[model samples]
Target chain A: MIEILDTAPLSSVQDLGRAPYLRYGVSYSGVMDRLALRAGNAMLGNAEGLACIEIQAFPCRIRFRAARDFALTGADCAATLDGVPLPPWWAKPAREGAELTIGAPRRGSRAYLAVAGGIDVPSVLGSRSTQFRGSFGGHEGRWLKAGDVLPVGAAADAAVQAPGFGAEPPQTAFPADWAPPDLQPSTTAVRVLPAGEYGLFMEESQQRFWDTAWKITGQSNRAGFRLAGQPLEFAQRIEMRSHGIVPGVVQVPPSGEPIIQLSDAHTAGGYPKIGTVIEADLWRLAQAPLGSRLRFIPVTYRDALDALRQGDAWVAALRRLAEQYRSLCNSGRTP
Target chain B: MTAEEIAQIATWLRAAGLDTLELTSPQTRLRLKLGAVAPVKELAVQPAAAVPSSLDARATGLFLPIHPWCETPLVQPGQRMEAGEVAAFLRIGPLLQPVTAPSDGIVGRCLATPGKLVGFGTKLFEFSPEGKAP
Candidate 1:
């Protein structure tokens, strides 16, 4: 069990998401940064989609009620275990009563804390993710509070190995030498694919959309990112009925500003969508700090598929390396 | 042993990825310590007041203090740190690789100049064990 000492308003439990429920008007409200959550889970030997704490607010404090190992990934929040600094994107064993404190993010946003076993929350609608709007899933379907005690799933025997046993002495908290090259966020651009409404926009608007750098506004959240840039004008005012939509759809409302739908966005919308960010690059936008500049580079459908394959390859390689390290430890050989 | 023999042993230590090497013979005993990139090898015949142990660069990058904004060095002479503590950092592109202490020790000397590029196996700091040598 782990107890929350202090936290911000949006901190909650999240897994991959509650999938295939959009037809029922339910949003797939899961982690904003899927890569970070998956990386943290992988470090602890948990399933990729296992539940973990999605910390959006900073200076959050958590206490371990039992001795267990945990991994911190995603944001570099200057985390400390009992006043000692912890390396980012690394897993360390914690003793009972150890208090972990996370400060403001140094880079990126949304840090993930995954324990050896996942966060033990009753799955709702096929997911352990908390959907704040409906208030029906994860820890009574709400954001985590200061006094809430969260149960941790039972850890596998192999997952509880001592530090410096299975893995070499980490040069940093992050697996700098082992992590895939593309896993790191690209500082400048995110790839996109044109949607149905791309041709409806004026030629200048289309050119600006591809050329202008958009600044993420403070209004952005798990719902969507409101980008600040040159307002895009349509070729002509046209009315359209509400249509089905998914996360990553870049919708432009009457104000001309583009809003990129995210994990918690509504299943349907009536606004014109100029383009949709590729699924592979959504994780990058999810971690983009507020007020950061971002550019959208158009890509072909084939390129988008190739990008996803690369991501899968990175994860597979990491798993193989981790398995080899564990085997060496079990065989009484130093890695 | 002569000073020339001691310098040769220091070069061998750098190649072997070792911090300190000690040798004993019936006639004489010698201990060689590597410090920084300079040829400042310390040859000790017996345990002295300062038993310096060298710390090597774990990765190739520009060496920086723990805090990039801070001007003061992360670890200084006479300061004590626990094993596994991050003593300094190596900045490779945007990533900062932490240089951790191998064992609990008191800082004796900082050899690598801050903000300078250092390759792997470059000597960075020298420290003496805090309690007994592990």
Candidate 2:
């Protein structure tokens, strides 16, 4: 078991998501950065969908009740294990009562902590993800608070064999040219495919949507990110019924500012969608700090699918590498 | 200067992808680079027989002084290291192998270039016994 010593609001348990329940008005409430969680799990030889602590706030502290192996990924938060500094994207064994402190991140916003085995929370509706609106999944389906003791699943025998190891971060492994170029310092460019309602937008609005860099407003969370940019106007107003929406839908309400639905966004909405950020690029957007500017670069469906494959390949490679390293450490020791 | 320190400087220079390094001070002028056959003043090359104890790479792979996501080097000069502790990593394609310390000692100098491919048994670091000067 691991106990939360200190944590911020919105930090909670998340998996790949409660993906199957979207039809029942349930948001796909899960980690904002899927790659970070997957990378951390891979380091510990855990399953891809195992629950991990998604730390959205800074200066969080966790104490292990027993000896355990854990991996810290995603943000470069200057994490220290029992007063000894640990490298980012690193996994190591911790003795019982060891405290892991995570400071404010210098790069991304959210960090993921994955332990050997995984965070053992009772799965609700086929997933351990926290659905805050329904408040049914995860640890009582609410944000993780101080003094909460979280159970850990049994670790696989191969886990932690090569503890002091790390994998390359995706951004570094993939390189800048692998994704759309950032137009300015601290401004990210994400790939977007025009949505069904793209034609309804005025020609000038469409141009502005592609050209202008939108700043993420403070009113952002797991639900969605409200952006500040040139108002995008529709060619004509038409009444329409609420339709099902998924994460990454860039919806434009009457106010004209685009809002990208995210991990915990409502499953259905009536706002006109100008475009959808590709599934593979959502993690990058999720990691974008508040007030950072974002630009949309249009891509084709084929390109979007390719990017998804690239991400999956990266995770698979890390898992395979970890397993191989464990074998080397076990057999290659020279007395 | 110690032979290990000179070797370490060579590794650092090569790791930075440079071909030459020259240092100038009031007391001495030193120039070191790949394929240099001459010894310089104040930086005499020690006899090969006087080489210090070292950590050698167990597997042939690309050497990494620091993990890709980390800001600090895995092992720094003068840091105390325990036997079997990971001092660096060797990456072979997607696989990574830990390069561990052979004995409890003070880290002396890095003998391998970071990001460069190294062969098995290549000297990776200079490690001096606890009571001895590195």
Best by TM-score: 2
What would the per-residue lDDT of candidate 2 be over residues A1-335, giving only the tens digit for each residue? 99999998768999989778899888999888999999888878898899999999989999999999999998888899989877677888899999999999988888999999899999988889998989878898899999999999998765465337777777677654744544788887889999989999999999999988999999999999999988899999955789999999999999999999999999999998899999988888878999999989899999999999998988887887676555445454431
Ten-residue stretch with the least lDDT total in model 2 chain A: A326-335
Q: Write the per-residue lDDT of candidate 1 for residues B1-134, one digit (tens) a residue.
A: 45544554455356447776555533345555677343445554554424337676744567875455335676877788887666777664333446767668876678888889876557788866778543
Error of 1 at A274 (Å): 0.5
Candidate 2: list runs displaced more than 4 Å: A161-163, A178-182, A332-335, B1-52, B70-72, B82-86, B92-98
> Residue by residue across B60-126, what tens digits does model 2's lDDT show?
5789888876668888888899876788887754445677776678887899889998765588888
Which TM-score value belongs to model 2? 0.84
Candidate 1 wrongly placed segments (more than 4 Å): A160-188, A326-335, B1-79, B86-102, B107-127, B131-134
Using lDDT as the measure, which candidate wins? 2
lDDT of 1 by residue, A26-142 (tens): 998999877677666665677888899999999999999999888787776788889977656657788999999999987778888888789999999999999988998888899
User: How does chain B score by TM in each prediction?
Assistant: 0.57, 0.59
Which candidate has the highest DockQ of all? 2
Model 1 C-alpha lDDT versus the unseen true structure: 0.74
Cα-based TM-score, every candidate: 0.74, 0.84
- Listed per candidate, the RMSD to the true structure in angstroms reads 9.1, 9.4
